[model samples]
Target: MVAESGNGVHLLYPVDLLNDEANRDLIKGVLGTVAERFDDDDTKLDQSVFNAARITKLYGVVANKGDHIPLAPWRLSRIINAPERNAVVTIEQLRALVPVAPAKLPAAKRRGNYPAFDLLDFLTRLGIGYRQDMHEGRERFKLDHCPFNADHGCGEAAIFQKAGGELGFKCQHASCVDYRWQDVRELLDGPRESRAGRATANGNRPGEQNAATGTAGALRVTYRRVSDVQAQPIRWLWQGRIARGKVSMIAGNPGLGKSQLTASMAAIVSTGGLWPVDRTRCTQGNVIFLSAEDDAADTIRPRLEAVGADLNRVFVLDAVVESYTADGAEVRRAFNLKNDLAKLETLLIEVGDAALIVIDPVTAYLGDCDSHKNAEIRALIAPLSELAARHGVAVVCVSHLNKAGGSDALMRVQGSLAFVAASRAAFLVAKDPAGDGTRRLFVPMKNNIGNDQTGLAFAIESAEVPSAAGHIETSRIKWGAESVTVTADEAMTSQGDPEERSALKDAKQFLIELLKNGALSSKVIRADANGAAHSWRTIERARVALNIQVNRAGFGKGGIWTWRLPHTPPNTAIESIERHTNCAAAYEKSGGLCEEKPKRNEPDWEEF
Candidate 1:
C-alpha cells in the first residue's frame, strides 16, 4: 500500500502512483467517507458505494499476484465493510489526480490528429467547468461544480478563469504539445472568418453585399418629350363636359321629380344618346343605376323603358340584395362603391367594360350621416374611390340637399364638407327660380375637372310608354320650360308659423337690397347702424332679427364677414315687401304702429 501525508490509502504492488491499484484504493477511501457522512437510510449513500465498487473493478484493482489480475468482488466487499477510519478522500483530492502535464502520457502513443490546446482554452473562456466523478472512476466534464463533491470541487476556480483569467491547462493527451485553451479558440475563430469571407465573395447572400449594392442604385426614372407632345386633347363624349369621377348633387323639395330626371340621364347614357350639351355626346358605355328608394320592377324598370333605354345595356340591382340593417332597423342601404366596383370587375369580365356607375341618393347608403367624425367617413369612402380608379369606371354619386335652404349648390349637401371636397366634380338640381312646376334647374356646383358655370334648365313631363305586356308606363322628360318662382312668405309659411313668416319676409327684403350689388361687410354695416363701438353680439342679434344671410370669408388678420341674399326669385322678394308693408299699414290702422322709430341722427318721414 502506498501512502503520503494528507493522501488517501493506495493499494499498489510496487507502490507506483500511476498504478491501477493506487487509483482504485484512493477512490474507494473517498466513497467510504461520503457514505459515512450520509445516513445509512439515504439511497444516495448506497448508490455511491455500488458505483465506487464497479469503478474499482474496471480499473483492475484486486488481490492477486499477476501483471493484470481480475478484480475481486470479495475484496471490494471487505473494503466497504471495514472502511479506513483515517484514510478518507475529498473533491479536492480527486481533482488533484487529473494529469496537468501534456507529457504524462507515453509520447509514442500520441495521436497526430489531436485537437489544439486553444480549443479547450476557448471552451473554458466560454464558461465551461469540469469535475471528476470518483464514484464512477471516470473523469466527468461539467460546466458547473458537482454538488455531491464535499470540497465544492473546482467550481469557484473554473468560474474565475472564465471571467478573463489567462491561466490554462495542458491537453489531457500526454503527447499533445499544445495547450487546451489556445487550440480550442483558434479552431472556433478560424472557421468563422472563413465563412464570413465566403459569404462576402458570393455577393448573393441576403442582407449582405448584394442587398447593399442593389439599394445603392435604386432611383425613380420618368420619361417625357423635350418639347410638348402634339397630342390632341381628349374630350368627354357627354355634352357639357361632365368631368370624370365627380359627385353631382340633385336636390329638390320631396316631390320635384329629381329621380325621374336622373333616370332620363341614365337612359341616354346607357343607349349612347346625346345629352343637352351641344358640343359633347354621351360617352356610350354600360350604365349601372342603383336606386335604393325605387323598386326595379315597379318604379325603375318602367321609367327606363319609357325613356327608351336599352334593357340589355342597363343593369338594375335587386332591392333585396342591396338591403342592409342598421341598429336593428331595416333600411335601404346606399350602394357601396367598393362593393359595386368588385361587382363591376366581375361584370367587366363577363361583358367588356362599363363607362358609368350612378348611385342615387348617397345618403341612404351612408349608415351614419349625423356623425361628425371625419375618419369614419373617410374609411368608408376610401374603398369606393379605389374601386373607381382600379376599374377605370366613371362614378357619379348622387346626393340630396339639406333641409336648410339657401344656395342650391354643392354647399347645401346634407353631410360633411368632405363629401364635396372628395368628389372631382359636383352639381346641384333646384327648382327654376323663374319657371312654374314644369321647369327644373340643374346647376353645376363644383367642377374641379371641368367647366361648370352654365346650368341646364329643362321642362319635365312624364310620358307614357307601352311595355312588353302592353301596359302603359310613365317616364319623365326634359322639354322646354315656361317659368319657375318661389315666394319668400309662401316658402316660409309653407312650413313655419307667423313669427317665421315675419322674420323671413324682413330677411328676404334686407338681403335682396344688400346683395343686389355684391357682397357687403356685416361689420361695416353694423358700425354704420350702431356707431364704432358696435359689438359682434349686437350684429348677430340684428342678423337674427332681419334674417340676413351671413358667412365667414377668411382667417386671422385677413378674415372678414360677408352677407348675401338668400337664393330666392325677384317676384318672391317683391311679394314679400308688399305683404310686410300691408301688415304694417294694418297694424297702424289698429292703433299699433309696426314701424321702427328713427334714431336721433335720422329723419322720420313715414310713407306707405
Candidate 2:
C-alpha cells in the first residue's frame, strides 16, 4: 500500500514477520538494500523508519506542515495505491528483492593525543544550529548548515561520536564527501602545530595526561593493597533480605507472587513506605521498571496504584531508541541486557536518585547469550551488579524456580548457578506449608552479607484503586507476620501440602535419631524408613539436607553403602531439631498467619 504523507510519500511494506529482534534486522536489511538500489535525486527513501516502534502516517489523516497557502499548503494524506486483496508479504518475497547494500562508513581512528572533546558544549560555544540524535551507540548532531559548504543545508550533514568516544564529521553531499572531523575541527578551532611545540608552550610533557585514562600515557592496570582499603558495612534496603547498591533476586514457582513482591518493593521505594518486617521508613526516590511479562497499563500500573505507589516517581523503560533523523524520525527497539547495559547506566544517571529497579523475568532480555552457561551468565550479570553498586540503587530481578522438586533451595533457581552466585542475596517465594494455601512465604535462599532472616508470610489481597472511571480492582500484598520459622528448603518440597511437610519432617527426625549414634547400612536405613511409613524418596531428601556422609564397606558382591551423620555429636544434632520444631509450634499456636499484621510485641525479624 502507498499513501501521501503530506510532506513526503509513504510506502508501507507488509511482511510476514514476528515482532522480534531477528525480524527487525531482516526488515532493516531489506530497507537498506532497496534504498541503495533506488537512489535518485527526485525522491529519497527514509531509512530511519525501519525500527519496529516507528510510527507511520495513517491514511486519511490531515497532515499540516505549514500555513494552508499555495506555497506550502496543508495536505490530506490518503491511500494513493492499494490492492483489492490485502495479502501478507512473505519473507521469501522480500529476500528476493534484497541486494548487497553499500558498506557503512568506516569508524574514525583515534590518535594518541585525542583531547577530551565535548561536542554539545563546543557546538554551543560556536553558536552553531544543530539537532541532537543517536543511532546504535553513537551520538549524532545534524548540523543545520553544513560546515564544509554553507550552501548545502540538506539534512545529510552530521557530527557524531563513535563507541570509543572519538568525534567524526560526515556530509553525504558530493561536494563535501572527502572532508573528515579533523578538517572540521581545524576549521572551528585553529590548525594544530607540532605536538612538542604545543606541549612545551602548555608546560606539559608529551602525553602527560591521557584523556581516557588520566595518566602520563596509556596505563593498562592499577593495583592496590588490602591494607590501603577501609572496610565498609553492607547497606541494607530491606534489612537482611536486600541491600542497597546491590543486585538481588527472588525466585519462585508460578502463581507464587514473585512479580508482585517486586512491585511491592517498588511501591515502598517510591512512596517512602515502611518496610513490613522492621517498620523502618524508606528513603523516597524514583524507581525504574523493565518488565517484559506483565502489561504496564493493566497489570503493573494497577498493582502499583492499588498498593499506594507514587505514580509520578515510577518510570518504566519502554524501548531503546537506536537512531533519530533530523526531521524527527526515530528507530526504536526492545532493550537487551547483553547489548544495552551502557544505555541502562545512562538512564540511571539521568534519573539521579533512583532508589530501586525491577527487571521481571530477566530471561526475556538475555539476547543471544545461552542462559544455561555459567560463564555467559556471569559475564552478563557481573556488570549489572557493578552498575547497581555504582549507582547506589537496589536492583531486584524476578526469576522462576526450576521444576526440580526436592532439590536444594539455592539450586532451584532457574538457569545458571551464577545467577545465585553473582548476587549478594537471593530469596525464594513459596506458599506456606504450615498454613492455609492463601498464605505465601518469602524465605531466604542464600545471603552473603547478612545473617539469615526468619521467613515472612504474606497474602495477596484485592484492592480497589480510584480511577477516572469509578474504580478498578487489583491485587496487592498484605503482609501476614515476620516470625515464621519456615525455610525455603522446607517450603519447596511440600509446597503448601501439610501431609508432605509432615512426612518430610518425620523422615528427617527418623534419620537424625537412627544415624546419630553410628553408621547404618543404606539397605537397613531404607527398610527402617519403609517400616516407619516414610518413603525412600523422603529419606533420601533428609539425607541431603543433613549432609550425611556415605561410606562404602567391603568389596565386590558384599559391598554396601553406609549412612552416618557428619562428625557432630548426637546431642547437638537433636538440640537443633528440637529447637526448630519448638519454634514452629510456637509460631503456629500464636496464629501469626491468620493475623492482618504481625504482633508488635513479638521480636523483630532482625533479632532472629
Candidate 3:
C-alpha cells in the first residue's frame, strides 16, 4: 500500500515472516536493498524500521508534526493507492535482487576472565542514573548522561547486556566515536577493590593494628636524596625566548597580533619550520591550541593556513566533554584549567607527538580562581607546569597587558606576579619604537633558562586563504628585522618621554601648516616628514593625536590615502604659514588660518 506520511510518502511491503534468526536476516537484507535503490537527495529510506516487531504509523491518522510553521502544516495521513489484490513479496525474489553479499558479522565478544558483575548494581553504587529497557532480546540501560564526556548534550548512548552475558556500549556522538565498552566498564567499576584489598579510612588495611608510636596518625612523606636524582639540561623551543618542558607567557595589549604570533609559533612547530630569531629547525610535531576568544574556523585555521602550517598536525581543544545525562544525554562545557588539566594531559598522551600547547588568554580558563591572588594562581599553574615538563611540551599562555605605564614589563602582565614567576620565560608584544604603527616588537620581559636574546619585530598583514567557502581575508604575522637594541621597557618608556612628546608636538604643527591649503595625499605628507628628518612613526602619532581625517580616493588597486586636517574645508584656498616658535605670529602669517585663540563665539582652531 502507498500511504501519505504527512510531508512525504511511505511504501509498505507485507510479508509472511517469523521472529526467527533466518527470517530476521532475510527481512534485513530486503530492506537494505530497497533503501539503497530508492534513497536520494530529497528523500531517504528509514533504515531503522527493518525489525519485524517495529510499529508503523496507522493510515487515516492525523499526522500533525506540531512544528507550527507554514511549511509544515498539519495533514491527514491516509492510504493513497492499493493493489486490487494483495500480493506478498517473496523471500526468494528479495534474495535474488540483493545487490551485494551481506556484510560480515562482528567478531564474537571476548568475555575473557571478566566476572559476571551486576551492571545495574554497579551504576547505582556509583550514583549514576539510568533508565532500563529491553532492546533486541537484551537488557539495555540508557544512561542519564554520557560517562565518557558529559559535555555532549545529545541522548544517544546506552549500555546493553546481551543474553549471552556480554556487555556493550554505544554512543552516536562523533566526539565519543573512540569510546568502547571497556572504557565505560573501567569508568564505572574502577580498580576492583574487593572485600580484601580495599584500604581503610586510616592508614592501615583491615584487621591490621597500628603499633604505639609518636608518628601515629601522621601522614607519610617520602623524600629522595640529591645523589639519587638525575639531572637534565634545559631544552628550548625557541632558544632564549621559549623553552620546552616548561611554562612560558606572552603578554600584550589588544591588536598587537598576540594570537597571530602564537599561530606563527604553532605553524613553525607543526611543519618543523625555522624560528624567527634563530634559524634552527624545530622538531616536527602536533600542536594543541585552546583559544577561548577566537573561532577555530574563521580566525585560527586561516592564520595557520596562511603560515603554511601542516593542517593535519594542528589540533584545537575547543571544549571538554564534561558528563552525560540520564537519557544518554551528553553535558559539555568549557575546559577549565583548574579541573580539566588532567583531561588535557590524557589528550596529550593520545596525540603522542604533541610538541606545543597554547592557551590563548589563559585568564579565560582560570575557572573561578582569583586572578590576583598569588596562592590561587600558583596552585593552578603548578600542575600545568609539571604536565608540560612531563610531556616535553612547551605550554605558552597568552595574556593581556595591564595599563600600568612606566612599570616593569614583568609587572604589566594582567594577573598576579605569580604568572611570570611560575613561567621560565615571559615575552611582551609591544609596538616597535623605530617603525610606523604597523610594526610590533616581541621583546623579552624575563628569561631564567636562556641567555639574553634580542627582540624580533613583526607586522600583522592581511592575507587570503582558500577555505571551503572560497577565499577569506585574515591577518597573519610577517616577521621583520630584529630589534638589537630597544627592549620592551625602552619602547614603553620612549612612548611617554617628554622629548618624544615635544617631537610629536612639532610634527603636529608641521602637519597643520603642510595641509593648510586643504587635503594632501598621505604619500606627500610622509615624504615631507622624511624630508623634515622626522620618523614616520612620530608623524603617524601626531596624526592620531590631531584626529586627522584619512580617506581613500579610489577603489582596489588604484586607491590612495589622502590626509586632511580634521574639519578643514575641502578645496579651501588659504595662504601657507611659515614654521615658527611664536604661535601668534604664525596665526597672523597664515591670514588667520592657524588660530592662537578662538574668537568670542567661534569654535577653536588648531595651531600651526
Best by TM-score: 2
Clashes of each: 25, 0, 18
lDDT of 2 by residue, 1-608 (tens): 77888878877767667767667756666766677678575766765565667676777878774335443467888998986767778888776665456355545533455444566777886666988888544588888877644545757788877443556788886545546676566444543432112443334555566555565543222457999999998877777778889998899988878877888988898988899967888888899999998889888999999888899999999889999989988988889898999999999988889989888888777877755555556778878988998998998888987654343677668776667877888888988876788999988888888756587889999888777777888898988756587777777776635576687788888987776555566766787787888888779878887788887655665555667678755454344344333443455677743232211122122311
- CA RMSD (A), model 2: 22.0
Q: What is the lDDT of residue 101 in candidate 1?
A: 35
| Local distance difference test, each candidate | 0.49, 0.73, 0.74
The candidate 2 region of ten consecutive residues with least summed lDDT is: 596-605
Root-mean-square deviation per candidate: 33.4, 22.0, 24.5
Tell me the deviation in Å of residue 483 in model 1: 13
Instruction: Give the backbone clash total of model 2.
Output: 0
The parts of candidate 2 lying over 4 Å away from their true place are 1-222, 324-329, 496-608
Between candidates 1 and 3, the TM-score winner: 3
Candidate order, TM-score descending: 2, 3, 1
TM-score of each: 0.43, 0.50, 0.48
Higher-TM-score candidate among 1 and 2?
Answer: 2
- What shift in Å separates residue 531 of candidate 2 from its native position after superposition? 6.6
Please give the TM-score that candidate 1 achieves against the real structure. Answer: 0.43
